[model samples]
Structure formats: C-alpha cells, structure tokens
Target: MLAQIRSIDSNFGRTNGGLNQNLDSLPENEINVKLSGKTKYTDYKIISHKNDTTIVDTTLTIQKEYKFNFLRKDNFELLAFHNQGQTFNNLAYDFTNISQFPDIGFKAKLFNYFDIEDVNYYQVPTPTTEIMYRTGLEQGQVVDALFTTNFSKRFNLAIAYKGLRSLGAYRRSLASTGNFRVSFKYETPKGQYAIRGHAVNQDFFNQENGGLTATSLEAFVNDDPNFSGNRGRMDINLNDAENTFDAKRLYFEHTFKLLSSKDSLQEREFSNLKLGHSFIRDSKFYRFNQGTATTDIFGDANSSGSINNKTSYLLYNNQLFIDFNSKYVLGRFRVKSDLSTYSYGYENLQNNTVGITKNKLKGDAVSFGADWNGRIGNFYVNASGSITPGIGRLSGNRLFGEAFYKKDSVLTIKGRVGISNKSPNFNFLLHQSTYNDYNWENNFAQIGTHTLGGVIESKWGNISVDITNINNYTYFNENSKPVQFSGDVNYLKAKVSKEFILGKFALDNTLMYQKVASGNSVFRVPEFVTRNTLYYTDEWFKGKPLLVQIGATFKYFSKYNANAYNPLLAEFTLQNDTEIGYPTVDLFFNARVRRTRIYFKADNISSFALDKNYFSAPNYPYRDFVIRFGVVWNWFI
Candidate 1:
C-alpha cells in the first residue's frame, strides 16, 4: 500500500476561549517551498485547534470565471477563482467579438419618377417651301417647351411654350401661330437679376390657286388699234393666285447685374444692364383672277366669259430697340462697350374693288460700338470701331486690329486687320404689284470690304490664313448696274490635334485643311477634313460611372456651282454638275445611372447626300433617318 501527504499551516495568537487545532505534514517528493529561489507546489493541508494560544476569524467570498480550451496550435485559456480570504481588486477582460463584412453592389437603379428640377429642350427642323401646287411634307413644325423652378433659394421661375404646324398635299394647312414665354429671377449676394416677358400671335395663310398657269396669250408688235380695244393692251399670261399673311409680336425685358469680380490684377470682371421693349403688327391679302380663254375673237369665236382681276394688301411694321453693354478691367487694360438705338415705321396698302386705301413705303437705322484690350509682356493687343446710320441707306464704317505673341508653354503669333461697310435689303427697296404687267423702281446697293490675316499656334499645331475683298472689289447691279464679274476671296486654313493614351483608352486625332482661291471658291467649303476619337472610362459603372465615345468624320467638297447667275439659268442652282465629294460618318452612345442619363446618336453614316441650293428654296436632297430618344433625371429636396 502507498500513501503520500503534505500539509502546512502557521498561526500565532492571543485570546481567551477559542477552540483551535494545528497540524502540519509534508512529504510528496519531498515537499518544498523556498520563496524567492523559485520552488512551489508543496502538496498541502493545514489544520488548527487552539485554546489560549488561539485565533478567531471570519471570512466568506466567491467569484468564478473559467473559459479554457488549449489542445494545441495557439492556445487560449483563462480561469479565475476567489473564495476563502477573497482578495481581488481591479481586474478586467474584454475582446469584443470579431467577424463581419458583406455589401458592395449596384450596377444601375434609381429614378423614382418625376422631379427634373430644370430642363430645356430644343429642336429645329426648318425645311418647308414646296408650294408650287403643293403635295406633301412641306416645312412647318417648330416646337419648344421649357420648365424651371427654385421657389425658395432666392426665388426663380420660368415657363415657356411654342408650336407651329404645316403638312401639305392640297390642304393640311395652319401656318404660323402659337407662343407663350415667361420668366422671373432674383438672386443676390450682390449680383444677378432678371425679368422677361414675351407674347406672340401669328396667322398667315396663302392659297388663291397658288401661282403660275395661264395657257396662252402673247401680243406686242406695236399693237394699237385705239389701245387695241382691250384697254391699253400689253399682254402675257399664265398665273393662278391666292394669298394671305398675318402677324403680331409683343415683348418686354429687364436685366441687371452690376459688377461681378475676380482679381489678381484682373482674371475676370463683368458689369451688365439690359432693358428692352417691342411691339409689331402686320397684315396682307390678295385675290386676282382673269381666265377663261380659247379665242379667235376679233369679237367672238365661241365666246366664253370669265375675267376678274381683284387685289388686296395691307402692311405695317413698327420697331423699337434700345441696347447697351459693358465689360471691365484696368491694369493691363481691357474694356468693351456697345450701344444701340432704332425706331422704324412702314405702311403699304391697296384694297381695290373700290374701297381705296394706299400709302406705299418708309424707313430706319442707327448703331454703335467700342472695344479695347491690352497687355505688354507677352505682347497682346486689340482695337475696334463701328458706325451705322441710315434713312435711305448707306452710312457705314468699321475697323478692327489685332496683334499677339504668347509663350508660356511654347509659341503663338498672330496678326489681323479689317475694314467694312454693307447695306441692302428692304425687300430690295419696295416696288409693288406685278402679274407681269411690269412696273419696278427703287434700288440701292452698297458694299465695301477688306480683310487680311495671320496666325500660328503651337504646343505643336495650328495655322490659319486669310485674304478678302469679298464682293467689294467690284460687281454691282441692283440698279446700280455694271457687272462683268469680279472676284477675290482667299482662304487657307490648317488644324491639327493630338492626345494619346492607350491602355485605358483615350485618343483623339484630327486634321483639317482648307484652301480656296484660284478664281474664288468658298461656299460651304470642305476641301478636306478628318476626325478620330476613342475613349473609355470607369468607376464602377454608376455614380462616378462608365463612359465611351467613338468617332469618325471625313468630308471633301469640290462640287462648286451655287451660282448667283447662269449656272445654267440659275435662280440658284446646284443640282449636280459634276465635281462633288461629300462624306459623313458618325456614331455616339452615352449611358449613366444613379441620376439617370441615356443617349444614342447616328448621323449620315455614309448616307451622305445633300444637295441644298436655296437662295430662297428648291434644290433638295437632305435625306432623313433621324431617331432621338432622351431621358435625364435629377432632384434634391
């Protein structure tokens, strides 16, 4: 049998009457407790019974926390216990439970219906002039609508409307009428103010058998049998007529913003004030007829009767204008100014069926300008001039100048000069009533122009050149008569663009060259043109999202013949006479979400065929295939 025991206890006391017993036993591998030399674990036990050599005490406490798991790789254990002379102070343990993460997703989604703070959309497709006898799709469709608001951050508001319609084939007409525009704005920290108003009412209609057709009649070889018994006969016929036109306009505007600033010796500065007013009214009407002919009548061959020539027209134009502008800077000088004043009145009317009212025509004009800019370090300068005055026309002057040299990141050099005067157009100076009974008078034409230029820009590219007389060296005949053809127009232009980065894609390449002058050719010039673009961007496809752009365009024009006269009896002709080269290619796509945006575009992808020659309509081939879809949304409240 075997037994092993070890115990130890110590006590020294002084008391009276207290039972106590003391015992100590040790020996389990020679129990030892030599403090400070590091020897522990003396298998132990202690007992004490005393009387007069006694001790009296009381103690009770309990505290327990145990979490232990250590069965290998990287252990962790904690055990605590206190009971029996419990003494434990200020002890703590906290290891805030670990493990969390999951959330990163959103490709596209967020457009919870209607709240497009401010939006303005515009579309203009002006192509309508096919009324020789009307058959379908003849120019007339103008639409615009605008909406705006900001009711509480300094009040602002806007509302606009415009509509026009016309589709013809014999009759599907409602020509010009519809308009409403309104605006009000007020913002101030020291700037911005606006008040605008507009109103328009227009109705114009013309259909009196709509133009030209009178089969036969021609006589004039000194014919006079006492005025030919046909009452002062001077005959030529073939015309069918119908006409109506009407108009009305009213406008008012007030704008002001005085002194906006940015300075470091003037980076930018502005001052503005505008005031306006307008009112206009116009009217026109015509009806004339005389046709029922198949004659051999010195008197009568089969005598058919129908001859009526009626006339009606009423016209008026009243205009008023007052405009002013300003810009500022000082200390390297920069200044600009503009002024305007106009008042006009005109009236003409003839209503015959014996209701007599006639008073033919009248006139007006006045204008002004000023400009300046300066710098002397990298050399920069500009100067300007202007004047215009009229009553019966011709009182004009204009002058301009420029000089430049810049080098901050390499080269720039420039030069410019100009002189000008021009006037003509009051319906070529009113001479009315003709159905081929010829009557014309009142013609005035004036023009004087000159220009010279130069430019060179670089970071590595740009060049421009010019020379002009532009219809002023000579060529006159609006009754000033004397035309044998004179010419002088010269232009040479060059352009280049470059930017490259290929890994994440961003590239732009452009080249353009235009040269004209070898007997003057410049009417929609496109001697050569080129373009290229490739772009890509990303930031997680939404918010700071993706973008892509692709491009291609190439055009070369040498087709010439928008003749002012005799490009084959030209009343404006350019319906193919050989030399033509027009090319076009384009594609665009855009998308975004989290504020919504989408766009897609395609334009004349080599379907290029446009033979537009309109000096007032007709010579058409601007084919079509245009589709547009749009959406944009943004709002915060």
Candidate 2:
C-alpha cells in the first residue's frame, strides 16, 4: 500500500516573481524518492490602474508542472527528473509568446563517490544538521533549444540557442549556474598545490510586435534618425514600436591554491593558501519605439515614443587567502585563523539614441579581511573584520563576531553582532533620459551609510534584530550645495521562532516585526504582517499516510498621511493619521500524496481593498480576494 497525506508548508506569501519558499534540506543517509505533477487555473482581472478609467479585460491562464527526485543515495545509484510547464491566456496573447519563439532547456547530473582511509580528519557538524562536509568538484552538462515560433509576434519573432558544460561545485553544491570549470591538485610531503579554470557563454534574442497599440504621426516626429553612427542600418530603421530588447553575456575565470603543514611538541598546525583571478565582459541592447500619443486628465499632452539603449561592461577581480590552525595544552585548546584579500575594477558605457545621451561609469575597489576562531573547554568564540576602499564603494568597513557555549545536554547559548557600511550604485547616481525633450535627475544628497545588528539563540528558541541607516550618519554635497532632509531614514526589524511536537503532530510558530523610519512622504514602509500555522500527521487505512495543515495571516496598516504630497490636501499629513479600516486576514490549506501536492490559498478573505504604496509600472492595478488552487507531481527513474 502507498501512503497518501495532505501536507501544508509555510511561505512568506510575498509574490516577488521567484520561487516562494526555500527547499534545501540537510543531507541524510536515507534513499528518499518522489514523483509528482500538477495543473492549475488562474483568473486575473485589472481592478484599477493608477486611477485610470481604461478597464483591462479579464483573462484566464492554465499551467502545469511535473518533477521527480532521489536523494541521499550510495555509489552506483541514479537520480533523474524533469519539469514541463505551459500557460494559455484567453486574450489571444500566448502567455509565453510561443509564436514569437520560446525555448526549452534541461540539465542533468551523474556522480560516483569514493572514501579514503588512513587519512586524519577533523569534522564539525552544523547545529541544524549532523552532516559535516564541504563542496568540491562535480561534473554536469546543460542543453537548451528554442522553437522559432515559441515567442512569435504577429509582425516579429525571436529564437534562442545555447549550451553549457559544468564542473566543480561551490559552497551550495546543488545551486544551478551556467559556468563550465575544471580543477587540478598536486600534493607532496611538504605541502599541496591546486589550480582551476572556468569559461561560459550564453546568447538570447527576441523580436515581437504583433498586438501592439497603433502608432500616431506625433510619435514619429520625436524619433531620432541619427541616434548613433555605430548602430547597424537595420537597427535604426526597425519599427521597434512594441518595446523590445535582447541581450547576451560571456564569462571566464582562473584560480590557484597552495598549502603547507608541519607538527611540533608545543603546537601542531596546518597553513593553507589560495589565490584566484577572473575577467568578465557583458553587452546588452534594448529598443522601445512609440507610435502613438495619448492625452491625460490634467490637459497634459503625452506622446508615445520609442527608445534604443545599449551598454557594455567589463570587470576584473583577484582574491587571496591563508588559513592556519593550532592546538595546545595536550590538544585541548584549539585555534584557527584565516585572512583574505580581494580587489576588483569595473567599467561600463551606455548609449541611448532616443534621448541623445551617452553615459560612462568606472570604478575600482579593494577589500581585506581576517577571521579567528578559538575553542576552550565548552566555550567557543569567532571574530572577523574587513575593510573595503573603492570609487563606488558601497561598504567601507565591516566587522562581525560571535560566541557560543554548550554545557552538556542542559543548555546552549549563542550570540553574534555585526556592523558595516555601504555605497550606492551607478543607477542611483545617473538619471535616465527617456525623450529628446524630457530629462530627469536623482536628487540624492548622500553617497552611502552604515548598518549594525545582533542575534541571540538558545535551546528555547532564537531571536534576532537589526538596524540600518542611509545618509543619516553621513553627509554629502549635491550640485554645489549641502542637501538636507527630514526624518531619521532608518529601519528596525526583529524576529523569533520555535518548534514544538505533540505525539504525531508537530507545530511551528514564528513572529516578525519591521518598521522603516524617515523618507519622502510619498514612500512608506508596508503594513505589519503576522502569520500562524497548525499541522497534524496520522496513519489511515492500513498505514496509508495522512497529513493535514491549515494556516492564516493578518496584516495591519496604521492610517498615515495619505495626502502628504498633495498641495491641495492638508487634512492628512501622515499615513498613521488617515482613518483606515480594519486589518486584512488570509487563509490557506495544502495536502500531499506521495509525489503529488495540492494547495488552496486565498488572499484577503475578508474582501478588503486598499491601494498599494509602491508601483513597479504605470497602469498596473492592485487586486483583492485572489483565490488560487494548484497541484504538482514528480516521477523518477
């Protein structure tokens, strides 16, 4: 008989375009296998678009995914898995632009492990898991091919072609990446030597124009015929009215390492050294053409336009490290120290013909750091610090230290503190030029700032808090004048979590609070949110597995000055002062059967509606009462 159960998992519930939850688990000495598949239906309607009256039609989407996996296996074992997903929207708009040409990609891996005896080793397992190991060389390959019509538009289309070879795993062994690399090592009685190299290339392109809004003569008048001399004639003449862009990147790297060790009566230790260098270059071009003009409410005339921008960037980096370990007092007390240095330089250039703007940015930086760890009796301490100097330096100096004490099985205490400085990026300093007659600039008064935080943990539970400030601790001049702003412009956060078990049932709870102080009246921190969940597992129907879980979340936002920026509205100056309604609550339930899992989730179960404080794009609406149901399955061979 096969066990089938309903399982519920916790998630942040924040839709940020990435996987919703962390899936990595500690290594175990068990052969676990899973196979699952799922299909889902989604209905989306644009409720409001920044006060716009143009109602976006409703659309429905259908999607599916399949996956499989095998874990913690011995030598000669095999694990294989694949995922396929498709989405269909009613708007005649292939959600994935299959007509414009889309592509399918896959990756696979196979490895054999061997153990060496008669070799002395020191192992330190992680507190969360009993596994003690480091990542090393692993071999794999990836292949991708796109169909010509995958992303086809009515007037244009695009296709992608690429392949990659991979070798050697990094700290997070299972992470997906596109670099092919090799490593070699030589050892002797006196010391050890090692070298490594990596190279990778990727290319992509797409052309889409069908379904675009019609262009008008007013938009054509703003077009720049002589945008750039280096651009090909075809690029300059392309309609590009549909806002399209394509890009590609290539990377290469090389590294070296050497170590030495010896034994003595007072202390026995090993000193290891490592060095690495890498060079990379990237280029990208995007074009957006406007073919129409639209009028706005305030009698302001807005014309449709297109833009083409290209940028090329290059980077060089070097790193060196040394490690030393020693023991004294009959091998009771142990000490370990490590030091590293890194330096990097980068240059970038961006050219835009639509705005007739050419921008160049260059910067170089260097950083050095050292860490020391000591263990005496049942107490252990670790300390580290680093300083970085550079033109666009985001972080100048950073220091972190931690201490942990364990007294048998009775209790354990752990604490850590850290402080650091940061600098702003080029985009924050350089303004964008959209139209020939339109120019905007960032009015930032500060270059960078600092942050400090600490954490404490014990068997009972764990708690952490951090505070960060930008421009409050430092000051800089903009446009030959000292700029000043109101508000502390700082952020504070705290979190705590613990787990409990009751017979066959398990419960976990976590609490978090965050607040951001200072900033322009138009920008404010999101409301405070809290979530709770309960889970139960039981055997049913002759040992068939059964699990059920349910959860709920609540969000509260204090009425603040909603009209702080409006010159005509003086009644409300702060968000907290506004007369807002009650908080919102959401509920969800999930179940699983072997490799198959299902989810039933609802957002804003109370049917509450509110405007979002932030906007990623114009004419985008915020929605409430979003209900979703999904299922997934996996298979392995």
User: What is the Cα-based TM-score of model 2?
Assistant: 0.49
| Candidate of highest TM-score | 2
Report each candidate's C-alpha RMSD, comma-separated, in the order given: 43.3, 18.7
Worst 10 contiguous positions by lDDT, candidate 1: 60-69
What does the lDDT read for residue 462 in candidate 1? 58
Model 1: per-residue Cα lDDT over 1-637, one tens digit each: 0011221111101011111111123223222223234323231111111112211111100000000000001101111011100011101111111001000100000011011111211111111010001111234444444454545434445455444443322221223333344444333444354333333443333222211112211121133243323321322222232222233333333334433345447664333333323222222222222344223211122224443322222222222322233334311222222232222112332212222233343333344545454445667666656565554443466776667776653576877777776543222233222221111233344545566766676656556565655453222232222232345544455556554666756555556555556434322244555555555534444454443333332333333332221100001222233232344444545444433334444544454343321111111122222333333332211
Per-residue lDDT for 353-405 in model 2, tens only? Answer: 33423354445555666656556776766666666655343336666656666
Each candidate structure's TM-score, on Cα atoms with residue i matched to residue i, is 0.20, 0.49
